[model samples]
Target: MNPKARSYDYTKKTDVVHSEILLPKNLSEQLDESDIELDFQRIADLVEIGETTKRGKMKSSARLAREWVLCGVPELTRAENIELFEQFAQQQSEEQGVLSMVFVHDPTAGDDMATTKAAAEGKSMAAPDPRNIHAHILLLTRKLDVSSDSLLSLGEKSDSELSNDERTRPVVPKKLVGTIDPETGKKIQQGRGLCSNSEWLKNTRKQWADILNERLEQKGIQPVTHKSYKDLGLTFKPTKHLGKNASIAERMGVQTEIGKYNESVNRYNHNQLEQTANSGITSSQQQIARSQRWIDAISTGDAYIQRQIEQETQQEKHVNSRIGQGVRRRAERQRPNPYEQQLKTSADNRKQRATELRERTIIFDRASERADRNARYRKPRINGVIGEVDRLTMKTALLFSSRRNESSSYTDRQKDILEQFANENSLVTGDFREDIRVTTTFFSDADNAQTHKHIVKLINDPEREEQNHSKTSKFEAESDLNKSTRDYVDNESKTSNTADLSVSIAPRRYRRP
Candidate 1:
């Protein structure tokens, strides 16, 4: 009820077919049957009368009585709807420690007179409309205060004294429980007041819908929801509710302004939904085409590489066989001549040189063959690693773009990773740093052989022990002054608000005092 209203006479309307008051179980016996009976005038008088405070001020309008319209669907009978509402009222009374008054109304009850007349004349009567079966639930915001078994009063507390647990005791709207008042520098606490929260209405709607649906399902009827189209993620627009005047006009075949507006909104919503669905389909098709092209390119590249590797292997084998035969013929020619002692020393030296060269050539050939075998086995794995890196890079880019308002620290980390990869491969360009094939080729150059070996060791190490050792050495080389400066800067940033200022002071020459 509005506190400023002149009267609360709406409860006395003729549409109220039945009315009853509900009380908490503990206080049920305290009131007489006549006192507990639903009388709107007496209830209003009780609500308006409040205790005087310590400051000698009458606390009029200290309590609120909220009215809820509990609707019934066509699937429910009038008796079932009344029973459901009664159960809900009792539950509220027990759990929330409040008083409830339920009034059931049937707008179609007037049609019963026509039905009775038709029955007397032996004529059939039309089915009554089921839309007007609803209940009005009046809930008291104040709990009953029981001092003794015989003494009962209305409970009221100052806003400041209300604890976290007691905040929800009153049938008031929820607010920021401990928000401080800027004007008074005091926390705004809970109190007995009118509900101002729109969220409360939404919650009540959902609760009533849930209750109705549960009862419907128990009776093997189709369940319904009370959510709006937008809440349910539906594209359709909902029609506005027509009041009694507009409803009467609409029934008389008149097109109301609201009806025309609703039709326009519905048409616009349908066109927007169609456009969105078409755009989504187009985007999905484009993505599919791009993925197919990538797959074809990868397959073609792998086939070409396989042919190249086979051709190189055959040429290497031919070159190695020729080098082996040439070394053997040189050794045979350099064999010692027992009859010529002078030439024997020279021949022995040549044979020793040939043997050394043959050993070196054989070792190089074995190393090259091992490298070829490793490359062949690792090619697919390398491609997989490259693909994974590409995916990660794209994901990072998208994330960064979406969160452009975020701090630059995240972008700095991405840059650090790219720089490290580039340094490992001895590459000047940071672009394509995530591509494994590009890095491998850059590291395979003759000038970068040592760097390539280090990178290969780093990859095989898995735990990066070598990198940690290098970091330790670098940390040891850092000067104490640099560390102190960094610490000072961090501390100043955290502890002080004022900026550092540079001051120049001349050296003072001290005289005998």
Candidate 2:
């Protein structure tokens, strides 16, 4: 407990704009102590006397009080902030019947370590922001016993000080089965349990956030949230809570380990924001490029049809060189076309992948919140390291499934993004090789029909130049090929044509003979 009014004396402190003590409404008149320090001192002589009217005289060394420093918006004055703390105090009083002291301090920036350090080092720099307006809430754990008419005395532990089970247990009634306690004239029934659990803490935090946001709204400022960054879908590192001593040392320009770490965290969060903004811009550009490519592909379909018609028209003429080449060997057959169906399929697949990635991200955020909502900045939080590791492994498996189902190929950009996501969350994803796999082997017989139709076009030609430019040898070679092809070519032309073979006869005869 903070004694000697050094930290608690807001009335005398220049930075303190206001100070007030809140007493339980239903307590006796004498229980209202104007001096907060006196109530704090009287706590030492307190005794946890059971339900008996006998003169209580034992002293206990239990905890006295817990102090909470309530923060406020700098723009709001002490009076505006008072309304917020009033609701907080009222809740504690009305629900738990506890005593509280509120001290609202004027703006003072204990926020900057760099500027403070520079000033301490005698650098000529502008002063840092003096806007850390906040309040001190000192809550006494012991309730004031009002049974005695003469002296103000400390009583049992406040409802907030009691454990969950202790508070939940049914209180013993003043009169049990028509039996009255002979020690006291009228019996006192035990009070209800106002002790806090995890749910209660969460509600309390939410209530505080709501109250603060309401005050901020009244001042026309932005609101704040009660949830963690992960829960809010914010991808950034969280700052650690530097205790009072570390915070004081930091503000005084004395470098603390946690202070330095917090600065790094701040820098990281800022960078994260910048990266997210840049990523958004890049994604928009990529989307526009994709749409342009789609339009171009659609127009190319018309070009493909036009090209096919030109090829058909060319087939009617009988050019010697054209006849020498097989029909399937034409350049038109080899020309590549952007298959509209394949493009559509690919687009649909990518869209599905984006949806799955988004869903998985949501699930991961929820899982992270469920795992470390309470001690987010603390190591080995709710779900310990091993549990977290296992969750991450499962997440890795899920991510692998998502990525594996993606478009057949993951580009460098996609891989980078995935790696970045995993790194940001401290996750070791499944072996990336497992992401894309060729399940069913695919073979494309792009070559057209090898029917006799191809053979009919394949004309044999002699090396006429070798025979001193003689035309008879070439003519005779062509005649032989023509005669040999006439039998099967006619039948193939009328029924299921396939090219019988390449021009092997002349080449073999020329070589063997």
Candidate 3:
């Protein structure tokens, strides 16, 4: 619980099912405190000495009320908890005339956070253990005076704070106790606070356990302990209580120092319990052996017991194997593998670095084939060939966003890939620069303009059926797409052409073993 929360937060909390202002037994009978009229806000103002500024507001460095969420028996209902709080408050707190406000926090399976933001926003950031049933008790250090006939006056700081020597002496005895100032001739205690001694705190815990046990026993439930394993003479370490932050971390499956410690403690306690159980069984067997006659123990009975033990061992082994496999499977799937994460990160980095390096030098290499065709028959315009050579000599990264249209060296999605890379690194896509394509050439003979024109005429002309069909068949056989490309040497006579086509295809490479 955050101590800085305002008094109104108690009533507004989603976890808080019911809240009421509680009075001491004597005051409850003597005074007529209206439940409808009284609230946490009014009670807080009455307890603290507020300021006398414009409208006499509470002064100084922010008024903060400390909050303690007293966890009750989970089995207890909201009403039972409120009742438990009343009994505990009256008996343990020594609140003779103290007015206290107790809020019963009853949460659902989906609950919950109690801070003002969570309550106001109506959402839970950290899903609490639904089994955790608790209460919030707010009591003022100042006492309610019953001496006044008409009005109940909020008196000086209660003896509860004064009783603790640690709070009085070192912290400021004169101000806290309202001791008369020698020079000012005034007794003032604007900052009234409460702090319990270690003995009192221990006693309060013991009392809580006692009262909780009483409640549990009434419902026929097993009573739990407030004492440590050491105090109870058990061979196990006690777990430390995880506070808000640690609990949130633990719930999120994050390993905190306290959470790890708790896990080890729980494991040790479980093992100790198992050992105790085994010892009990052994002790029972010894008793049986001692009680039995010598002949009864020796032959048939011993053999029967041995057979029973062997069967049980086999059955236990089978069950344990199944459980072990299931546990291992779940751990593998559900547990975060650090090595797997590291490898994934490494692979991503490697791939990205490789991509960047390729795009950086793509101005040079083409290993895997593009266009799915041999480059032997491509032809380029005289101007385009000269322009490409000149552009290469400049040795600069060309802007890649507009370069994908160059069908020769760059794929259509080359731009998208580079843009994605740039976006990932928060670099501008337009600034992702690389020059691969020669600007005017196409990658394939299918991109040839004359081939497209000839195919269109073959399909459209109805009169040239015989020529079209004959040529279409021949074209389909001898690379239909690249048949009779713009590069010219007579088909029968292998002679060089007089002039070049506008688009260039790479010259055929000789394959060698």
Candidate 4:
């Protein structure tokens, strides 16, 4: 058979028998060495029969005692050491309700040292069978009162500040101002303050509870309260548990009931300690969990923040680049040009003005020619030149001709017409008429009246006309018509006087009259 698969059963008559103890090397070495002698028989005597000798048991009674000695031993007798260890176990049970039997069985004599130290530190070390180590441990396992002084005093205790100079510190009672009697000048200890209205009374409850808690802490008692100081200050209902007699607590025996209430309160607080211990996680586990959550949250938040910052930076860079490009383009296009727009406008206006001036000058020249042609300063004239025959000569010539007798004998009307024409022609014999007629005929082609007047003034000088028209024949032709008019009148008078006497003498030869 293989050594790893060996099995041995030891029993007798259907009752389980004790198996041979197999100690580890260190325990065997201590058992064998004379100098490290241990009282295994004595340890067996201390244990209950079933605890040490039962078969199929995981640990034996003697092994338990031997394990304790193998670890570092404390400066205590075997029995005293066991009692100290038991106290630790009891303390653990009272504080944490789930009793840890494994902690009690921990194979370390250093744990015994801790128990002995706890005794010195004013913690209970009372265990069963004070002379025997195993019996004392067994009695502790059954039940024991564990002193909590060491645990309660784990942290630094608050100490009242002491006056360096020996003057007494004033002790003031916390009460409303109106609670002080005006006449007696003392606090009205019997009743509530006059100013203890609803608001003040609400706050007074918390003030009272704080005073109570503070006073209790002075006497080494911790107060356990569900309501926070802020809640208590607002509203506190002690009467729900105390009833209406709460107002007259002393006379109604409610004071005694209140004292019992405080006692129960202390026990309840102790119970709460155990409850809280059971519910709380170990310090190491709590710290690890809290740190992990915080790290996860912070890492996620930091990554988001970093991404946002990077995005903003990228956008800013893009915007800046665009702005820079725009500025560069503007700079490239920049130039100084003379404003041709205004110059073009001015040139256009000047050209238009020149065109208008030319048109105006043409109009003015036309108007000047028209004014010269129609000049108002020229004088009128009448004359007996070839183009302007003497009006009287023409008229006389027409009358003396035989055609005048055939048409009609000269009536008075015809004679008047002939005379009127002679008068108007200025042929009624003015000194100026012959010169005017000569000058008028000379200036007939002068287009304007003013030009006619100038030429007439120059040429109509009597001496100039005589010099200009020196031929006498031009004057004789014009004078013939006037001489004929005088002859015809004389002939007409002789014929009328000779009548019939001269008829036979032959009608005198009729010449062209």
Identify the candidate with maximal TM-score.
2
Kindly report which residue pairs in candidate 4 clash with one another: none
Which ranking of candidates, highest TM-score first? 2, 3, 1, 4
Task: Specify the poorest-scoring 10-residue window by lDDT in model 3.
Answer: 436-445
TM-score of 1: 0.38
Candidate 1 error regions (>4 Å): 1-15, 32-38, 51-63, 111-129, 146-153, 157-203, 248-256, 262-513
The residue-level lDDT of candidate 4 at 310 comes to 64
Per-model TM values vs. the true structure: 0.38, 0.41, 0.40, 0.17
Stretches > 4 Å off in candidate 3 = 1-12, 33-37, 50-68, 93-96, 109-127, 146-153, 163-196, 272-513
Q: List the candidate numbers ranked by lDDT, top first.
A: 1, 2, 3, 4
lDDT of 4 by residue, 16-120 (tens): 111122223433443455343324343333233323334534333222221211111122344443344444334333422221231122222223433354467
The Cα local distance difference test for each model comes to: 0.57, 0.52, 0.52, 0.36
Q: Which ranges in model 4 have alpha carbons more than 4 Å from their true place? A: 1-199, 206-264, 281-314, 322-513
lDDT of 2 by residue, 1-513 (tens): 212213343233355666667766776245444322344334433423332234443224545566767777666765777778777876676565767777776645223444555577986444433666677777777776654445556677766676776666456765662455578755444545454466566777788898898777775554677787786456878888888567666666678999899989977775565444333422332333454454455445556555644553454243323533543353345536436544654575567556655765675566445544433443333234333323222232333334333431334444555456445534343534223111000000112111211111111111212243346678989999999899778887756433334433335545654
Which regions of candidate 2 fall more than 4 Å away from where they truly are? 1-13, 28-61, 107-129, 167-196, 241-254, 275-513
Q: What TM-score does candidate 4 get on C-alpha atoms?
A: 0.17
lDDT of 3 by residue, 294-378 (tens): 3343324445545655665575567556655765665567658856755665575567556645653452233212211222222
Higher-TM-score candidate among 1 and 3?
A: 3
Clash count, one per candidate: 0, 6, 9, 0
Looking at model 3, the pairs that clash are 51-57, 378-505, 379-503, 379-504, 380-501, 380-502, 380-503, 380-504, 381-502
